[model samples]
Target chain A: MSVKHALLALLEQEPMYGYQLRAEFEQRTGTTWPLNVGQVYTTLSRLERDGLAQGGGEDTEGHVIYRITDAGRDEVATWFTTPVARTQPPRDELAIKLALAVTVPGVDVATVIQQQRSATMAALQDYTRLKRQATGTARAELAWSLVLDSLVFAAEAEVRWLDHCEARLRRAAAELDVQNSRLTDGTSSVKREFRRSTGETHADRTRR
Target chain B: MTAVLQLTDVVRVHGEAPHEVQALRGVSFAAYAGELVAVMGPSGSGKSTLLTIAGGLDQPTSGAVTVEGVDLARLGQPERARMRRTSIGYVFQGFNLIPALTAAENVALPRELDGVAPRQARAEARQALEEVGIPHLADRFPDDMSGGQQQRVAIARAVVAERRLILADEPTGALDTETGEEILRLLRARCDAGAAGVLVTHEARHAAWADRVVFLRDGVVVDETGADRAETLTEPAAR
Candidate 1:
């Protein structure tokens, strides 16, 4: 996710041109997150401008090589030690869909949840299959497997969330059924008062 | 490859007149040798109905259900029961292991019921249990083993006599995530080893283990696609 830090870390190993940096990054990460040539140049230029990297003399092929500055090394060190922050979670589309589905009257919430669950499960299977195909002992394989594992874990969490949503919706429907039956048991007015007092809170909980 | 199990224009209607429920409305499906096809649908969408018809546990109304090119309807009740015992394997969500029997005994029960020698049935059961990675649990009773282990035994029972058509209904429903995946892997492996499998599951991830997915809705085959495309089909479209 931090392309700058990744580029900086790669540059720390040796002086390299834009293309070499891109190749090295992809090689190390197993090309899971490919780095484009233009993006590499842009990041390199930013690094130079920010005093984190300096343009070195051209190589024999007239390609401009870049070397990491002391500041870049410090940044890479810090990035490696810091844990990723989770307080401000990324806006997940599936989460947003379910949240909207619960409150929207016309939406088929069960279908929405089931569809998303299927998608996440497919992704999880892809990850698992990919993991099985990757049989390497290099550090790149290790790095790539870690990245793949993160995706697998995220997809697994998504599936569990979808299952929870389905269960909650079923519970809500059952409760609604129970309320409807009570309404017909000659306690309509009393039941209406209870619903008015507590239904709002229940609705809020369901939305969450 | 020839389909080991095929349902042609299968229609299964329950009850009569006003109370009749068309659980499967002209549904046609097939599972070829060495292929695992997952059947997915919401509850009461005829998923179980489809699986039962395919396994010959239930007959379809005004349609054909064939296993290994043999029509199930043409067979008498006794022969149909024999077919179920020797050629078809069914795994349920409940594990469905006989608590009174040991794991090996439960697995061997199907083969023994088909008139296999007790010694031979037990040997085949042990081999099946070993394939499921739980050979040591063979002597353990259903109540003595963990849920995952019980499910493995159930799977062993399903495949004990080398049944070519395996039908599973939410086989991984009761297990933890890791164990569920393990069970799916076993099913996938079985299909790879020349068995035809039909898995009825609500979970898309489990279906990913299959070669193809058949989506059902309102007792109809809504969409049939490769497992890889399942995610794209479910993606939210632009309104």
Candidate 2:
């Protein structure tokens, strides 16, 4: 999740050309983090300027390669062992929905989940149609194809997960019990059943 | 209390036909080992229904329920009755200590009801008082002590039998904030002692002390998780 550290970590493995590094970054972690050769060069340039890394001159093709310095090694070691706590931006979309759901008559949580699920499913259908239309035989086309597959799979999974979530929420919503025990006999119920076996009446079983 | 004994989906309906009101629909929540869970909801939201059903003081209108893994709904009426007597310790909103009994005697009542030897019950009651940090109040009557002290005595009483499940329906509702916190501390200690408990509270402050907080509405649990689901759990509950 930490992009800077992840790049630095990859660079520590061995000397790599900017293009090679970019490609490897994607191949390794399913790089949702977009990696560009220019970004790799900029980072390597910064690392060389900081003395935490150095350019290994150039290959016969004139592409510069990078190697880590002692300081860079220490930074990568620290990065690997020390966890960076994730700070997600506060998102209260669900909470807002729940709060509003309570205010509207007949708009319980089951209906809410159902509505969300429907929209997500619709989006999945759209994504599937788009995926089917994407074609061609270029490298970019292959990459686009993979991205489309990921998108469609993720959407379908979200729709399925939402369905399961809604079912569980509905099951929980259906089981709210209320406590009220009083009858014409004035015996009350619940505890009265316990009191009855001993022939105790309401007056006799009155708790202090 | 340490952990929840068990709970099943509990639903209850009031009245009949179109006039019928569903108190609880299908509420199911659990208190964990050494966990002090608080169930909070506005009036008419089935808070009491959850505590009572889970405590086995009443059967759910429909659904399975278990206390300490013993199914309350499946047991014969008499066995379920005995389970209530032996496995559950209840502290109601009312102090409800016997007017004539001293604090120690009130604390010992559960054991006495179970036919525990009087001397043994007295010793156990004194120890429970000490556990709740109020052994000095053993001789005092409920009226003699402050409301806070009375609740401590109530907690001592509730745990005297070492019931695995201590179901307190608004145990501190009648007390002021300071006293309420002291009572919460005592309940926390009970959980440390390996008794799992459920505390019903309207106050968010009280509910946050629980390892988990369960929010109910319309006789159902709407949200439940660590007291702080989106933020740090250490943030204290607002009074």
TM-score of chain A of each: 0.84, 0.52
Candidate 1: regions farther than 4 A off: A9-24, A27-30, A41-45, A48-132, A135-208, B227-239
Model 1, A66-112: lDDT tens digits are 99999989998999999988899898877787788889899988778
**lDDT digits (tens) for residues B28-57 of candidate 1:** 887777778888777888999999888888
Q: Give residue B222's error in model 1 in angstroms.
A: 0.3
Chain A TM-score (model 2): 0.52
Error of 2 at B14 (Å): 1.9
lDDT of 2 at B148: 87
lDDT of 2 by residue, B1-239 (tens): 21255655778887899699898999766666567777766678899988877877767788877776667767887787777767888887788899799999998888887788999999999999998888898999888898888888888888887788888998888999668867877787788677787889765555545666676778988766453421332233652
Chain B of candidate 2 vs. true chain B, TM: 0.90
Predictions' DockQ, in order = 0.18, 0.01
